[model samples]
Target chain A: MQGLTAHFGGITWAFVLDLFTDYGLFLVSALGLYVLMSAGQVSLGHAGMVGIASYSAAVLAVKFHVPFWLSLPLTGCIGMVAGMVYCYLLGWRLSGFYLAIGTFAFGEMMINIWLTSDYLGGAIGFSGIPLLARWPVLLIVLPPIFYALWRIEHSRIGLAFRAIRDNETVAGSMGINVARTKLMAWMIGGFITGLGGCLHAHRVTVITPTEFGIYTSVTMLLAILMGGLRTFWGTVLGAAVIYFGPWLTTTSEPRDRLMFYAALIVILMILRPQGLLASRAAR
Target chain B: MAEYLFEQFLIGISTGAIYAIVAIGYNLVFGVMNVLNLSHGAVMMVGSFGVLLLFYLGIDNFWLAVAFGIALALVTGLLVERIAVRPLKGNWWNIKVATLGAAMFLENFVTRLTDGRPMPYPRPFKPVYYTIVGDFEVSNVQLFLIACSLGLMVAMMLFLRHTTPGKAIRVVAQNPDLAQCVGVNVQQTMVLGFALSAALAGCAGILNAVTFGSTYPFVGQFLGLKGLVILIVAGIGNVRGCLIVALVLGVLESFSVVAGGSQYRDLVAYSALVLTLLVRPHGLFGEEGRTGREI
Candidate 1:
């Protein structure tokens, strides 16, 4: 009991445990973004993806009484299938700015729907969800997920993703199915990110569309970008930075905080456009 | 009833003209350099706010204030290009995010200064409604807005087509490497492009503040998005198309306010944007964007 309840640095043990849980959840989402970025795809809708899983998990929990553990993989499967289908159908036509804007629009539309829907409790969002995804659950789940992602990062398909990221034309000429590879990235990334979202919803016990918008999505992108763009460790490091940077700075005011983050991002881009973790590619 | 509808149509024209200028701003930089200049909208807001700040500082002449605002916007645009765009050196995503960060930085800086409050705009003259046709009313401000935008648009079209600098912009747009090889000062021309676009944005931003009655820090986010939406729907570089679409959407919005209340007004434009992206991502007149993807 004493070991479990030990405090550190003016922070209580429960807060530390929660912080760990939160960081893990963010890492999962960051890794999802990492997969897509590795394939040179830009999605400004990760918050919406997380929202989808959260709402789906909420409905599953409320309507079907699905257990927490079962719902985790269930939501991920749904996200994977949804991502694959969506990318295969309409995503192939979109490449650069269009893809980014389309995803942004997707996020906006989701927010609109949530705000207007009565079933989802509209703007306020529905609550009273069971907090089944405790820190222990996060601990049990995260290691395997990270290990799997590391394995995937080194796999054959991962190489295809990188090939496409560098240059699609060359990747296509090499007989890699560019569209299919992108779809694979989105699908797998969506799955892991979906789990991240599910864990978040279950932990918070309440989900609101307000918390998931373009700003949040942009912050997610910033977090990952801050860590590093291409490296696997960069994603993890980004999650950590985003999770803890503000807390360490002790910036309590929202306005100051935004300005700080904005300045950091702008300065970082100017100073190290390649991000902190330089890629293996010779500049 | 016909006269009332006509008055509504005129109202639509004024707003549409403003949108046209905003879209043109987007097009100028995009056409010449393939840079999105996402901060274009914030620069727009800065122009109006510049005028407002000067007014508060006791600059009595509105025209002079407007001139100063244009200059301010030009500086902001150049700063954005320098900080957000030039550093990345053609990395699209980094540039996009950086520009967005710059925009966020500017917006918050202003917001912090103002305590996130909306400031009342200062117009050159008080609006006076004239009975143009037996109870059909027209404000001098509206007429001025419509006339000013039309004149600016015509001037821009002529400038881009006739001037040496204009041709240089077109040449640079076609192929920057070739343009450089041909001894055209690419960097200077790019600066000229930003100046031109920023000037237009300044005009639109001030016009927006006048029409909307108040100016706020985040005003650009919504209005800037509308400009981007117009740009996308009109097909990135199509100035004429942008004008037509902006006017048509404005009229549609006017009529929508009549038919379905003001609530559904934004839906008309946003849905159109989404549809265009879904149906034709290249924009209606765009030649498959090379900035984002490969052929």
Candidate 2:
């Protein structure tokens, strides 16, 4: 909702401004959720957790004079631990709806803690982290990340994880270490989500608890749900739609935006219960 | 320090009682229907708003306001089940998302209708403190809240164990298909289950208003999450577990606030859920008695 300014401006600002941030956040967040969900862990709170990571990274870089390179990975590691803990607790036994609730609660807790903590700049968030995520950085990061996600989802490990999601007892009987696979998925999901947060922190140059809360998490889920939860490319497509759809459609009111999203989720779930790309097609 | 600790303990019990009521509703729905009611808290919020509306309309009597609120919550719950949940029955994930949709719709709709202003709910008892044990002072409202909550919980347990409809509900919960074959009317049972759950949540809303003295549209947001955590802590699909866990949460929250600050109160519930779930997935008390419908 916070639109960027283009003072070094002109016609390019309109094209560049909308293209970079709006579409950019949408794409990465969508891709991230898609990959995570395909790996058999649905992160309803990735938005909030990622926001925390990004804000943490940004604050260390700007206020504490920590180097960006040092700050980013450190933020990622923190998120990794958070994700592992979340999984180690709830993920071992819970799946589907229960897992979603736990993750969502964890996300809310993180946001609340961030909002109340003065050291993290409280609700106002931190700003002015160096903008190191540019086209070149995107070019390097996007391909490898996408490739890795693709490779993992196609691997035997991915099959085992999916089997767990489908039915854990059966998978366990088949010799899959459900806990280990789930934990690994959680760590990877958190690590990537943290990476996204770090980049987001640098790109926006400011972070706030408001940015991370339920809305962001819902939006990220929306991206995955709409594009297609199972297919890797579907997530990218879904992200693009969620990111750029409103701007292309209409910017009427905030309520309208919420309505649009709600409508999108309802439609997708009803129309494609197996997700946008049918499971048959994915197989 | 002792006095402060004692005072906070009283506050904690009362607050925890409200959570216990909500958690009980969640436990009932989960126990019977096997579907999580994401809109259970939303229905409770509607109840709080219903009471506020009644109060605004000159129905200032506390009990009268509560009755009005409960009736409204009952109708809302029935309608919610018919429109939002029934379509997604038999599919757990779909049901979860559907309820989430209902929750989103209700939350945003309320926010829009109110222009984001919190609806003020008058406390049943005004701020009046009485010293206890010659040292600590506990608010009368807090004591009343705790008493009423414990009473309601007992009443629920008695009803579930003794009443005809309650037995029917338990039977339906244990085996809906078999219950249906025995002419239990599965659809009607689901409706009743939701209605019963919603009514309890309404009571919780009233009690929460009594404790906090104000009701915001988004109050249920946190309460919903808390209920979910309590559900897990008690072990999903277990009513008795929910009650015990909720009390534990209340006591811990109270002590945490006393030991740290009010801001840290949530840390207690969140941490407890994280820790307990890590150690025991089915919860300390949960023994899965066939969650959801028969596959």
Candidate 3:
């Protein structure tokens, strides 16, 4: 019994470590999307923001010889600015389905631009990115970020977000600054997504426009949807399922894996449309 | 240079006609159901594949193949409505996500079936070019496509105006509960609406397949998005408005290709959509306060 416990303990540590390194980016993205959805706006273009950051960081680090640490936060700032511009331009005018479509178009445009530009390494992809992120780095970064998000989820701002999400007009009647709250959600969400992108660029050591296409955005949305949009921990669980579930399964081929993933999503949606961990109040 | 631009403009018209057809179908579904069918493009692809399969099976007539393909698309549309749209009727966001899932499923399934290679469409008609005034030439194929698209648009307009089912559909679009109260079969009308929309999309898909001389599984993705853009630009539920906007989009797309390279085609198109959204959130013909919901 003692020998079995020791052997399992050694394997478990390695497995858990690998899981964190592999899924850290997805976890971060899920958190960003959770914030947006919590405010009752769905962004189909979160992956586009992530792509912008990844490319910016990779180019700055590799071409300009910027320090990795500086490049990371710089990418976050760029993401925040981009998000602010996007929200200011379209967030007020569009909501619900229209917003989804507009953001989707934005995502497609980003990928198309990346695909067409030669400086961004256009179809062949940009490679030789320095590996500056790992399990340890994620561990140090993620907990504090999670704590911050948790605090936001419980604060007055969080309460306002929930109110707006439930009904915008009512929230406005209740004296909440609906537009300002929505923009704030976008800003924070964009920064976190950008940070995730920088981590992904360093970890994967290569970046392609294809990696940040509508499919990536859809997958991220699916993760949040499956987990439950109302709670931060639910989003974390969803992100974990998305990143690690396929790895544990026996699906080896890429096509088969996608098929399985899509089928799983359909089944999950039918079985639990409100999500697996929907807050009781929301239900 | 003038002649080349004229030719490009004509080419844009043909392509735009296809976009108009797809957008009309999409607009119809959105009008009646108030839900965007993300799988509409996939349904179009299925139509293309159906026609291609019929041709491969020794159907020598192009129009016959088109008819069978449209029929197949109609059936698929009904299936999608039953499975994806109906189950999540009340929840708008869930319906969108489910339809997206359905889109992915159809696209990936077709991709796997085709082994990830594009299939060349066999041309049934011989290439015959007719020289027009000012030394311009138009092919019989292009003329056929343009004429057919216009004819179908007219037919659709007439159907909606004169037919009993068409009037029923419009009634439902205006108010489903009221339509039901007035003895209209809402379920059947919704199914009919899906069939008609899918039929239009299928026709557009076949026309596109013939125009390009090739078809693939994921071809619908871009066209589907473009159709949505056209629907938005023209104002949702406005058929005539969609036709005009689609043609303008196609012309703009061709001009962008001439100004920049072909790679910037999508960038130009999507940027136009974003700009339009910024300038006019309700679209050109859409009523105020009728941006997304049916009023």
lDDT of 3 by residue, A107-149 (tens): 8788889998899899788988999898888887799779989
- In candidate 1, stretches whose alpha carbon ends up further than 4 angstroms from where it belongs are A1-20, A63-65, A130-134, A203-206, A250-254, A280-283, B1-12, B132-135, B253-266, B288-291
TM-score of model 2 (CA atoms): 0.86
Report the TM-score for the A-chain of model 3.
0.90
- Give the range where candidate 1 chain A is weakest over 10 consecutive residues by summed lDDT: A1-10
Q: Point out where model 3 deviates above 4 Å.
A: A1-20, A245-253, A279-283, B291-295
**What tens-digit string does per-residue lDDT give for candidate 3 at B1-295?**
7777877888889889899999999988877787788889989999999897788789788779888999988888788788888887556666777777777777888787778699999675998989897778888988988898888988998988899999998999889999999999998988888889989888888889988999999989878888988988777889999999999999888888888878888898888888888888887777777656321
Q: lDDT, candidate 2, residue A219?
A: 68
Q: Give per-residue CA lDDT, model 2, range A117-231, as digits (tens).
A: 8888876776667877665556666787788878987898778767876677789999998778888877877777777787788777777777776667876776676555565
Clash pairs, candidate 1, are none
Q: Where is model 1 chain B poorest over a 10-residue stretch in terms of lDDT?
A: B286-295
User: Against the true structure, whose TM-score is highest?
Assistant: 3
Off by over 4 Å in 2: A1-16, A63-98, A105-119, A122-124, A132-140, A154-157, A172-180, A240-253, A279-283, B57-62, B125-139, B288-295
**Model 2 misses residue B7 by how many Å?**
2.4
Count clashes in each candidate, considering only residues at least 3 apart in sequence or on different chains. Answer: 0, 0, 0
Tens-digit lDDT track of model 2 for B135-222: 7787777778889999999999998999978888898888998998888887777777788999998888878876777888788877
lDDT-better candidate, 1 vs 2: 1
Which pairs in model 3 have colliding backbones? none
Error of 1 at A277 (Å): 1.9
Q: Which ten residues in a row have the lowest lDDT in candidate 3 chain A?
A: A245-254
